[model samples]
Target: MRLRLSALATRPWLVALLIGLAAQALFAFHLDRPGGIMFDEVHYVPAAKALIELSGPRNIEHPLLGKELIALGMDLLGDNPFGWRLVPSLAGTATVLGVFTFLMVLMRGRMRVAVTGAALAMLNQSLFVQARTAMLDIFLGAFLLWGLVFLLWAMRGTRGQVLWRWCVGAALLGLATAVKWAAAPYIALVALAFVAIRLRDARRAHRPLAAALLSGDQPHWPGLPSLAGLALLGAISISVYFATFTPTFFYLTGATDGLSGLLHLQREMYAAQVQVLPHHNYQSDWWSWPLILRPIWFFYAWDHGAQRGVLLIGNPVIMWGGLVAVLVAYAVSFRGRALRPLALALLWTFSVAIYAIIPKSLGFYYYYHLSAIFLCLVLPVTFDHFDRTRDRGWEEWYVALALVCFGYFYPILSAAPLDGPMAFAHWTWFPGWR
Candidate 1:
């Protein structure tokens, strides 16, 4: 029994499975409650149903993959609340597993760090809210994380396996872009990072740079992809993104039957997305996102004879503490103390920085979802750093505090029954939150 238990404990797949199941259960619980469309469901759910009937178009500013998946759920389960939300819940669960896989690879198979990161990701308030609602960000997040996961896997794969791994990573990222254009920056980041690393490796190995570029060899990390491989990966991603639009060609109202139509649709999407719009009450700046300056209230009303609300906010402990963790990680990296944490910090920064360059004039707190999820990586890395420095209890205390905050905010985060009409006051610690 002891040996069997030990074996079970060491199996990362089993552990990841458990984590994914727990996340799904949480996202699915009371998912059918509120008994009606909440927030953007009014946009995507109808859009999804319309796609199924091929009657008209809706929500044209975004890509089709997310709505297609939502439509699949509704078609299979009946066009009800459960059907509308089930896919996003599953995507949220996939995001948890992606976090686990990503950290596992980044940390060199340290199960503890991976599991801790996944747990924090599962508890992130934004993830919880987006997972329960029919939204595109969670889909974007799941694909984005898995894309990075595959890229990390490519770094460690054998020579014959690396190319295929890169392709898979690029494909997933392409799917992410198909879900939303926000994912496009990540692809650029990946391509640029690969080019830089490949060039660095060639210089270090004393190889002729031009020769190495054509041959696709790396001295430091053997099997690292070459420029040619990167191009192929980009092509694969673009193909995937284009393929997602195939269904749109058949849509009765917004059909795009050829390449010219596809180009026209792209122009329409760009016009709709970037056009300046009236300010939203919950609109926030990118800089203030990590600070949790504002949160979007997806739902607030009397349900089952009590007040309930759903607030798209990050867990305070994780958000605030993760910010500190990123700073500390950067400091340590500058002093030559660590390299991996530094990479996480850079990725976290880039995720938020993409929003700054995008042409969109309006932003919401929920746009910070990617940044909040990346904090899961920073948190575990910080815990590992503390453990190495003889600060053994920080991880435990961090997890405990995170769980406590999650419970305190559970009522608002999950649209659970509140104490009274003013129950929101309990969680609204700051005036801005109101």
Candidate 2:
């Protein structure tokens, strides 16, 4: 048993994962001490409070799971700002772990890529900020990624493995949906992508592939048992989702009445979301996001005496670097040199970009669904190129560049109070950022 445990610990990806989790947890703990609602937390904390009281206004649009989770934190920690934000922080940390594990599975345990990806994700300001706040994005993002991770794991496993993964994926999807309805489209897209890929493979083999594909197999596929296993797993996952919610859904509100009530609530939420007439200073279109044209300022403060302050903004270097990396991945993949990585990057980037163009009524900068996933895709490509070239000097230069960029922007990302002039200096770089 000791030997087995030691062997597991020796895995570089696992070691890196442990370290990443620790770093995230520590950062979250430090940030948790700031005991006041910031930005959207103002909206969500009240919503969660209403949820706990059961007599407050109902948010029919979003599912209760995320709010309920926040309430649980508040219940244990006292309904302070820290209590409300704790769950999302924990979820965000867990997402780093999940991404590591998923990438480990995807790369078949490529230690360098896995470790780099997880590290980059943990350090990302967008993800880090979301994790430290009381919002649905982190919770939903974590679950959605978890579900996809399991699905990917199943795809690469044996019959038993596939079965286990499929069930986990389905259950996760249900939980994801419960957190935010936006995840539903991602889940559907994944399912559709899986089907399309399978069909393509079947056609390439020129065999009667529908039955085999539906069964999760090909004529000469190595893992024949996986077909039936995946089918069963998918079925089990869907069942788990319904099973968990149907009761709360029926009890909290009467079944028939609850269903109707839920629908009514949804309509109200939809109308509120679609109201485009209302104007706000921070409002921005989706196209500008890729260019880092506008960044939502989550928190800011001033201190005349201290002559210092904190401003929460996305790390421009990482954000802009990721954008370029995506483009590079596309260019490389267009040449058919490294198809898989490019395909993953393209799918995630494109999916999020398309959502931006949909003219949705209530889109926010936080609507960057591909946020974490984009980092995941970019890190691997960056590392892969560096590894193949074996250019230590260039790698050092890249690290130095990333560090300098992050360091320069650290004061802004952290909520450290700054004087008005200093704050204006940071704002001067990105005028539209404010």
Candidate 3:
């Protein structure tokens, strides 16, 4: 039994995952801190509380899965700050695990680089800030990150592996979408990427294009699904998404009209989302995201004679360095002509378009988390191909710089007691960040 436990402990990604989980717990779970209602907690926590009572949900603009998870945490831990914030904190840890394993896969078991990637992801202000709050985006972001990773694995897997991964990925994608419609772009991207991979594979075979796709590549793709089988995966996703709203089915809210209310509720939510709000202190244009400008202020308080604030900013090193790494990835992929790297570049480009076209009047720094997750994939994956000494030097600087940025910005991200309002404001190096 001891030997078995020791063997299990040595499995890949376990140490990295434990480190991430522990670190996230430290940052998030507070017995007596950030102890009152937070920015969006005002919306999500109460909805979750109402969910526990079988009362009507207060917010219908977003879906039920995230609130249900919050309710579950509240049930397990009671309705307090730690209780309400619990699931998101775990989701944040899961996201760190996702990033770790994702880089592990791409780098072919280079554990150190993968761990560094996870550290970068963990320290990023967007994840850190969202993890500590009861909010929708972290849940959405975590699901999408894992779902995207699973989709990539499914696409690359052989035989029964492909089928199982796709099935799991579909369900995860569904869960991601259920948390918020913001994940729709990722869902669509993964679906398109799946189809594209199959279509490309079909060209190598002499079979009919549709049949080749449905049948999957063999010898190379034994035991993979047919068209009907793929449809089943999609159905599983739809079912999971619908099932998350089971509570809604039992109790009608302003969003849900009745048994046939799902469609009406969806339309109403879409309408609400698209309407413009011209005035907000921190709203940003899409152009600013690449530069990490204009972080949205999510919360502020003057309690017990101390000032506090929560800002959705990205770590400068990760955001700015990752941007440079993206261009490098594009160059390396184009020059090396690597299939996966090329796909990563295309996905990043695609995300920029998706971000630009969103109809919301406000886009904020936090929305860039999706781009950041994808960019996280680029650095480690590219770093693996670099010469040994240079790779070491680069990663050393990357980790040190990212950690320094995290330290500099922690007061603002966590709402730690400040000397005054401007104490946190002083951390903003750029005029635009203010």
Candidate 4:
């Protein structure tokens, strides 16, 4: 009865929207805390400031769209900690809304579980920490999630709406890639998903693979407009990508020789990203991230009477528990051949691919940020299944556990100064974390 009431919110969309705003509020509220640049803020905040002052290229390894967005925030909010980080915090909140909307769209009539997923995303330690800082990853990730949602919506649209939705999705991704090339893989994954969905639909309808390729299958997937739609989507995506570089195009003209300057600049950025580097203090392999075994220390402070440390890491409750949930889902999902399970598997696989393939040596702990959110998304599936089947306990317990951890870790994550050395030491449960 309580479960049904929970689902009976008068307008679930509004509830999700409010949750998004609340999430944003939570991230935005502490902008001025533990004052000064933290972590990658040292790099991005300066670049953002440079863009505002029209200073020359800085943080040249990445494109300037993200910095430009940050500059806009600084322009309005003032050039302090709050101002530099303002847009990233808001983008993080908007990401929560996007995730909620996507889950609602993905799972028909399953508002409760969708909300559960978004809420988990809100609290995941790594995601929450990443969102709070002035970093490119959060901005890149927020737009990627939104674009994927819109792309899925396009797949569900009529011919008339399909083109428009697809174009919009492409445009968002174009901007996302401009923020950080890390989003390039997401764009590729979506194109790949379009083909996979069409193929899967044809096979489900018992059409011969060869014949379908030759002439297309009967009763096409409601989720997919057509195979030719793939071509159209790709073309629009490329055009949108080029469109995002307009600022870069002109910015380059001033900073370099000509159109050749643009090409040369891109090559330099690419070279920097792939260049090998020696071990650093915060560098941790992707394998350790899932276990919460390694974390980046963003800042440490000692005042006349206060001491505080800002550690970048995941919440053990979600990281460890979510890992178990995914293993359970993987084992059970294949046994039934269900669409929900299959979709879950594909989405999980994509996020994993993004992290797993990254070089283990140069990997920063934050590289695992998206994977942590993916696990959070996967973490709830097992619990949602239990609720639907009257096989319960996991959902309630998991939520309880997550809430407890959220408060327990709030001090360090928010950059609150510690009461004493002992208090700070207590938060580090593992030697590697210290």
Candidate 5:
């Protein structure tokens, strides 16, 4: 009985992932041709067009890869509304896949947890809205999540497997950095963590420093060879990122300057973002995000002879539940048994939270808190404990409750054209959410 249950639990999460991806794709299709650019798409589309023309200045605020990807869709689709949004829609779907894969790996192939995470992420308002628009957020998120997946794989694998993991991780990090520089620090954080883990294990095992010097020979370190491989991977990723901008930098601008231009651009962009303090209706603080205090309205319209719009907000059920679950995970993880899950929860939580305190005046609800989508996964792990200790039927009850909550609020979240009273009812859940 135990063997059968274990086998069932270990089934691959690919089916759930496909279902989630398909759902997002269907949602994207619904939004295939929004009449006009939604909020940030205004900035992104023109920037992308300029990029395609090779006439636009290099934007230090974001990497070129996402714009480049958008340009591809524009070229193929003739630069219409559908064309502009196609890439983000696809990228968003791909993020669902990446999240599913990450959860599967983290949960040791537990289908239940993996499916729950992917489904919740797919349905997340911020993730869904970003995916349906022509913006860099989904692109940045995709690459970052992919890199994280690779990092998790590397942590679990042996020396021979570590090289491949590092290589893939490097490539993903490069792609992520090319979409948004915000993802760059995570690569360094993971690398430092990896090095620390290996060093500690080496000391624990009492391995001689000389033995550890050998490549891929040490049991824990993967030794010097692994480090060399990681270095090579880093170089390759960085080379790819720089190579993409080389032609334009050298030919168009006659700028033979290396690295200085990138640094200068970053400084300018940072200054531009930090100095702006004009009050806005949708502005929210980092402290309020975990509480789902205020969600940014990405799109709204009432003039099409009827009310219709998309309001991007985190799923209230999942956001609140996951927030609590993360606290529980932290407590349980300190006991050692839940260490891995606790580490991932902390990583996901801290990565976004630290950025929230950056003191940049223009920080928006969407900028840093997007990482919270992953927190939903932590709740399912918490549910697993409930399944073990509580009633065996608790899993079904929990899932049903979550689905019910999602369905109840679906109209407001998806802009399904609720009337004044209906909308007012939804807004009453959190007065500030309005």
Candidate 6:
């Protein structure tokens, strides 16, 4: 057993591939369940159909890429439950793989840490429910995560390959924003991080910033192009964002003409998105999201002589335990001056911080999905912090505990038949959840 574990740990790419395939299978299983549109599918799926028919845009408050993907899926798969949800399920699988790759790179191919983090990502309930639904978050999340992955790759790539890697990263970031405006802050963060790193390197090297930009010889951070070059990379993302609106140009009546029309559409979307709305039964404050204080019920129904529902709640084992893991990881990183773990912790913070400053009047638990993923990364570092004694046996047991919790909650997360009509009551552990 020890030999097998050791061998697998040495093959991080294989572990990531296996994890990705398993996630894809799990997400694809029984994806047509509940027999109809459950929650937000009521909004986006129809817009997709509308897009396919050159009908008017129905859900114009958001960008077009997510709906476009849904339309593409339906176009290929014949417009049923399978078609509507295929893209999200695939996106979800990509998210799990992205999480694994991010950890592998960040931790320098620490396979155990990457595997543990990726396992936690699968066990995190929010991803499962969101993946099965036709919502936009998972799509945006996959792009954002892979975008970060490429950014990390750019940092370490050979000089010949760095510029293209950086451009690919920037373009993916733009695709994320094209899916949802929520990705705007992350794009800004990427650009700002590039500028900050270049400026810092210039100061340390005692060279003028312009000289550094022109030389394109960033020591310790090779391959990153000049500031003007990066701005053009940023334009790549903006152009990608603009290109997704091409389908909107074909709309029967409200066809967007060009750059001016796209700008008009964006203003209209901003107004629609920011306008205050009535209270929601499952609406939650940004602070309560990490606590799992309230979870949105994507679907709850009695069908085929059985009762079942899908709840967008995080696995308590991870949600509650991750809070402690983050704090411990923080203390350990700060004490040891570990920059990598600190970076993971900060990424988690910024993911949540986007919500705290957004102009939207109401928020829901699903908004916490991105931050919950970061917790997966943070939890593994916490384990590494304590594994100084070289006993990795505990990590396996921890993953086992998470797996048990996932099994216990599987019926609720996946819309599987429940034991009785009040089965949902058993899963709702708090008043807010009710």
Global lDDT of model 1 = 0.86
lDDT by residue for model 6 (1-434), tens: 34665799777767778898999999989898766888889999999999999887788789999999998889989788899999999999999999889888877777777788888888888999889988899999999999999888877778887888888888898899999999889988877777777888889999997866766788634855567556866798899888888888788987887879889999999998999999988889999988989898888888546787888899888888888877776777768977676777778888988888999999989888888888888888778767835876767788889999999889988889988877888877788887
Candidates' TM-scores? Answer: 0.95, 0.85, 0.90, 0.91, 0.86, 0.95
**Per-residue alpha-carbon lDDT of candidate 1 for residues 338-375, written as tens digits (9 for 90 to 100):** 87888889989998888898999899888898899999
Tens-digit lDDT string for candidate 2 (55-172): 4445545666788788888887878867887788888777877777776777676555565566666666677778778888888888988887887787776755655566678789
Question: Native-vs-model 3 lDDT?
Answer: 0.74
Model 5 per-residue lDDT at 246 = 50
> What residue pairs clash in candidate 2, if any at all?
215-227, 308-417, 308-418, 308-419, 309-416, 309-417, 309-418, 310-416, 310-417, 311-412
Question: Which model, 3 or 5, shows the larger lDDT?
Answer: 3
Task: Find the candidate with the highest lDDT and give its number.
Answer: 1
lDDT of every model, 2 decimals = 0.86, 0.64, 0.74, 0.74, 0.68, 0.85
Candidate 4 residue lDDT tens string, 127-183: 778777888888887888788778877666665666677778877887788888778
Clashes of 2: 10
Displacement of the residue 374 alpha carbon in candidate 3, Å: 2.0
Q: What lDDT is reached at residue 328 by model 5? A: 85
- Give the per-residue lDDT digits (tens) of candidate 5, residues 1-434: 23443565645554755565586665565564346777788878887777667774654466578888888888888677778878887888777777778877777786666666667776566777777778887888888888888877776778668667867888888888877767777777776776666666667878765444344665543533546755865796787666656534633443436688766765766776567678888887777777777777666666335465666677676777777888888888886688655876777677666666565775567874346656756776776654644546544555566667767766655556668534544554667766
Model 4, which residues run further than 4 Å from truth?
1-10, 206-227, 249-258, 303-305, 358-361, 389-393
Candidate 5 ranges with C-alpha deviation above 4 Å: 1-17, 58-60, 158-160, 208-215, 218-226, 250-264, 303-305, 356-359, 385-396, 420-425
Pairing residues by index, what is the TM-score of model 1? 0.95
lDDT for model 5, please.
0.68
Question: How badly does each model clash, as a count of residue pairs?
Answer: 0, 10, 0, 0, 0, 0
For model 1, state the Cα shift of residue 1 in Å.
Answer: 18
